[model samples]
Target: MEPQKINKGDRNKIYFLVIVIAALIGTNAYLFFKDRQQSERFVTVSTEKDKLRLEVEKIEVELDKVNALNLDLNEKLVEEQKLARVKIEELKAALEKNQITQGELDKANTQINELKTFVKNYNDQIIQLQKDNIFLKNSRDSLQNTLRNISNKASNLENENANLNAKVKTAAALKLQSAEIIAFRTKSSGKKVEVTKSSTAEKLSVRFNVVPNQLAEKGHHNIYLRVFDPAGNLLADEGNHFEADGQDMQFSHSIFINYNNDDSTYVIDWANPKPFIKGIYTVILYADGNTMGKAQVELR
Candidate 1:
């Protein structure tokens, strides 16, 4: 019975030791788990902090870029404003020049109208001068005939004396008249020469009258015209003997006419195939080597 009690005591001691060892092992495992959980939490926090820092840097860079773009836009706006100012000044200058040109045109129109009126009055004076010239010529011819008849008579004294007195009377009746150009006038259709957008040709109509010079030879005389562009270059003509002031000249066109013992009116039509630049144009007319008239026109 003593041996059995001792074996039972050893068995109880072994069991108690095993229980203590188990308790120590459980404590160590609990500490390891807790430490592992803490490490995981720290890693998570560090990763979040890095992400937030990166987002802040990205925001700062975007703000910087926006600032640069704004500066560039401001610079462009300033340049645009300068260019706009220059354009405005140019437009203002052009408007002023146009106004001045309009004023000059009005003055020229008034002068041309006055010239037309003067030419009409001059025509009337020319007709009366022609009649006076004819009467003077007849008186001179009668005096010449009386002188011839007196030269033939050589015999009777009183009869000769009376013939001399009659010849003297006829000589006193004779008169002299000077020949001159009566008047000249030109008229144009006030309508502008229209160049259609799709067409290259244009038509011009001009009308004029020739003043009578009673002493001038009654025959055919050549007439001419010259058209000039705004650039002062002569327009081309396919037909016409181009001469001006007894010199060969480049002309737009020419015409021939017979002025047979009367005042005359003339109208001419001209066709232009060349493209015209937009500006003022001039037309000069010549008759019998003399400048008869001129006209100005504008095109837009």
Candidate 2:
């Protein structure tokens, strides 16, 4: 058998076939590598986006905790809590897109971390403020309690003083039961004769019985007598004015009676320098600065 001779046309056809096969392989390899690179980049973006979303969720939770504080006492923190929630919403919005850049991710991560720090600091501040409030409240309560105690003590002292004053007044009071007044003229024979004619009357006698009281002190007490005539003038024989219980009053006469916490009788005499003429005469007896008894004597 004889070897066949190679032609240029056949050789060119073989070279062209080799070039077409090589182009098909190169195109298939480029498509495969490009698809794999796209898948890997998508996975990275998804992972970063998920991470940012989770961070946002974390921030939301922290915001809820911060907002849980007492609003009345911590009203100043309301704005801070709102701003944190706003930041969380921004993060959520940023992650909502199907695409994310490296710079956006970095920014989100940093902001999330900063927000966490802010939340911690704000929470600590709120707690400290609340503690201060408690301290102030307790201090106010203590002050109020002290004032109340002082007021109560002062009231008790006043009550005690009032009781003491009442006791002193009771112990110092004197009572008189029976009172008698007689108008008569003394005879020249050194004897006493009762007379009802005021034109000839020469003397006036006053008598009273001191009531017994165990509470009153035993002492020589001065008794003042006020005698009023028909002209409404006090029959003052010695002094016209007498002081009783810080009041200056005009009295007719006075006598010292020795009291021993028992019933005692006393008689006092008053002399008229002039002729007495009256329709009715009133006699008021004063003991311990108070009017104790009174009596009337009638004369024609």
Candidate 3:
């Protein structure tokens, strides 16, 4: 079979068709590549945004760690921390947008760095404050030791002076007169009813009168109470101590009252933590480094 012969008009027509088809193919290829590049760029931007978000989270975690230390922060450091948190929140808000431009991303990055710097400065200040506090504590302890040594060196002479002072204080000390103690059962409605039964007694009601003394200083005084069970065990809370007659003594409760150098009546209501036992309970009162009075109550 003979090959088909090409004429000028037909040949031109064929060339035109070929050119049109090639142009369409090129246009389609260009559009496809452009769409693919745009998709890749979007994915890269999203990934970077996520990474930035994670970095912000890390910074926030660091801030939380510092906050958990519970250090007493000064005014400046507190304000700096507040501002850092605000900046972090702002960055987070900006990054939450659906589309972030490169410029916006760069800006966020710069803000993040500033936030890091602020946190570092805050932490440095906290460390310095801690060091200062430690130094102050050590200085206080050293001064206390030196004073104790001086006190020991003059012990005998101080004792004679203290003895004279004790005589004077004893004369001026407030005394509890007509001191009385009674047991009571407190109801859920907060009413107290007198009770002599050990199983029903929940608290003790103490009443006393302060004897007038011309030598006593008229001012506020702390009246300490000491309760003893039948077993001779002092009833007191843990670490409840007061200074009495140059010695540390345990007491159940202390009351603050005002004295006008005249007879004044006072009351102290004490609730026992443990149930009352069927025995005698002794109540002693002290003020101004001396025993004021003692009273006893029995529960059957």
Candidate 4:
């Protein structure tokens, strides 16, 4: 059996329907594939965002560790830390978005790497500062020790000088060898006669010989005399005093003598204003602030 042929208009309509169906299928396929590509890109962006978040967290942990060290930071270092933290916060904010571009993700990654470098440099600076502090402490300790040693040496030298001055003062003092005392009276003819009786005595004479000393100062010497009666009463002049052995003492009289550093005999004559007593009279002599010698005479 043979099939009958269709008309040209019917064939053209069928062809038009087939072409429309093909266009619809092609459009649906393109739309479906485009949706799939968008979904994949979104997933990739999410992964990148997660990776960036992990990097930020890691850097934050590093920062926390460094801060825990409690190092002393300078103003410049503190500012650098602030800037790094701000950058990290910006990165975290960008990653929090549901959508992010490759460019933005790459920018975040680059900033994170910069932060790592900054952290490394900051740690290095802290290490250098610690070393410097240690060196300065050692130097200060050494300087203090040196100053203390110098002060000790100076104190020792001062003590030695004081001792030497004391020795020199002792060596320069003059000494007297012997002393004698005599009582005398002036007669009616004005002739002075030596008397043994205290009732007739009007004046007492004290004589002493100074031992020759080269260390003694030569020129003139002021000799102070302290006379005491047998009753232990000092015959002192009013307001007449002199310094002897680092103490002030009242003296009966003072006389000037020329000392030639040779053994020379000197006499001091003292008149008693009161009546002489029948007892011993004692005399002490001082020169150059020292006791030279003493003498006594018995009056009958």
Candidate 5:
């Protein structure tokens, strides 16, 4: 009976142990399944986070490109604006210079018209004087012819013939009056000078006057005025010519005058129409083969 009881107790103990081991194995299996599910959920979250980070990086790159383009465009705009402003200033300066030149041209035109009118009047007076001289010449010739016929005729009284011949000779001796040239005030002043219209070397205005004499013959005569540099060289070109002392000479410039009265004043203005250098200039007037007057001036 003792052996049988021992066997029963051992079997009961083995069975109880087996039951406890099985319970532990089941709990471990449940815990392992729960852990695996949690791991899968964490992996999905990490993948989503990586995708979001990549998208943000791409957007940042695009923004940087846009900012670079904007900067380039702004720089180009500034350069163009600067170029426009510079052009505007240049145009303004050119316009102002043109205005000044136009004004000067107008004034020159007016003076030239006045000079033309004076020349026309002088020519008319000369024509009238020529007519008077022709009549006088015809009268003198007729009187001389009559005296010659009377002297040849022996029938005429001798004393009367001699007296008439003497009168005829005296009348034939009379001739047209001679012309005189008036001198300038500055002829004795030995100075050389130049005159310019502007300081910028754009143009020059030259002016001079001529005097008339009544004792001169009523005829068309050429007057010459020569402009010279400080070096005593003629400033005018070769085409100009005038009559001086009953001879024709190549001059710088000349004007025609009909002497009808004494103290006739004449003025002439010349346009340089070219650039000039800084220096002194001299002016000389010649008429009837004589130097009538001179003037001098300076320019800087």
Candidate 6:
């Protein structure tokens, strides 16, 4: 009935084991807290991608405003719009794969910067255009006043018409070299042959040429086509809408041309929703809000 006494070495070993266990537990707790902090601070891929997407949407909205103004008569703004859209697509693809990296984020930001710069430049140009227009208007008024004083009203009106015509001529950014539309039959064999009768018409092949114009701001151009039947029904395909002079309008089809201020050819095939009728078909071509040309065909 005597209490057992522990050896000194055994007591020291026991103390050492207790200290080791306590140290291990503290280290593990510290590591767990540190990892939790890092996880809380981590940004997700979707967040970054959403930020990029918002930037793209911003750029597109600005570009749309310019387009609605119908003052972006060149391809530069359109090209910027295209580039922004391309970046959005890339971001979407990366987000789908969950592989969006910091580098992709940086690239998307770069595109945003470029698009913003473009928007600023476009706004500046628009302001300058407005200033020029005001100057022109004031000059016309002064000239009219002088003409009235001198009884040269007829000459004053002629001068005004001339000025308007000059603006119109300069506004014709792209000139037409050639344009044609040929009706074709799409056979059951998936072969095509030129057809004359509307009954045999499967689709209309539209072709046109952009003549070189050094004055035209060169890049990518969106060319629109409006096909009208005898009853004036618009034949539409993709790119069936456009904004012209602050008015929304519908177009039949559209194609893009990279006009390096050089002659280039483009074509688009249109298959109307309804069969062709035996009547006159009119096709008009427009580029950057300016009508390049028009032609008509008699379908018998």
Clash pairs, candidate 4, are none
TM-score, one value per model: 0.31, 0.55, 0.50, 0.59, 0.30, 0.42
lDDT of 4 by residue, 1-300 (tens): 889899999999999999999999999999999999999998888888888799899888887877887877789988888888898898899889877789988888898888888888887887897787778889889999899999899998888888887677667776778888999988899988999998889999888898888888888989999989999999987899889999989999989999988878899999987888988899999888888879999999
* Per-residue accuracy of model 5 over 211-264 as CA lDDT, tens digit each: 434344455655666776556767676676666545776666667766554444
Which 10 consecutive residues of model 5 have the lowest summed lDDT?
178-187
What tens digits encode model 2's per-residue C-alpha lDDT throughout 38-112? 999889988988977887787687667655764454456777887788888888898898778878888888998
lDDT of 6 by residue, 52-118 (tens): 7777677667767766776535466467557756765665565455555667677767866776787
TM-score between candidate 5 and the true structure:
0.30
Model 3, residue 127: C-alpha shift (Å): 1.7
lDDT per residue for candidate 1 within 20-85, as digits (tens), equals 999999999999999998878667555544443353344334334434543323464445435534
- Per-structure clash totals for the candidates: 0, 0, 0, 0, 12, 0
Candidate 3 runs further than 4 Å off: 145-157, 160-300
By lDDT, the candidates rank as: 3, 4, 2, 6, 1, 5
State the local distance difference test value for candidate 3: 0.88
User: Number of clashing pairs, model 3?
Assistant: 0
Candidate 3 local lDDT, residue 158: 90
How does candidate 3 fare on TM-score? 0.50
The TM-score between candidate 6 and the true structure equals 0.42
Worst 10 residues of 6 by lDDT: 71-80
Among the numbered candidates, top TM-score falls to: 4
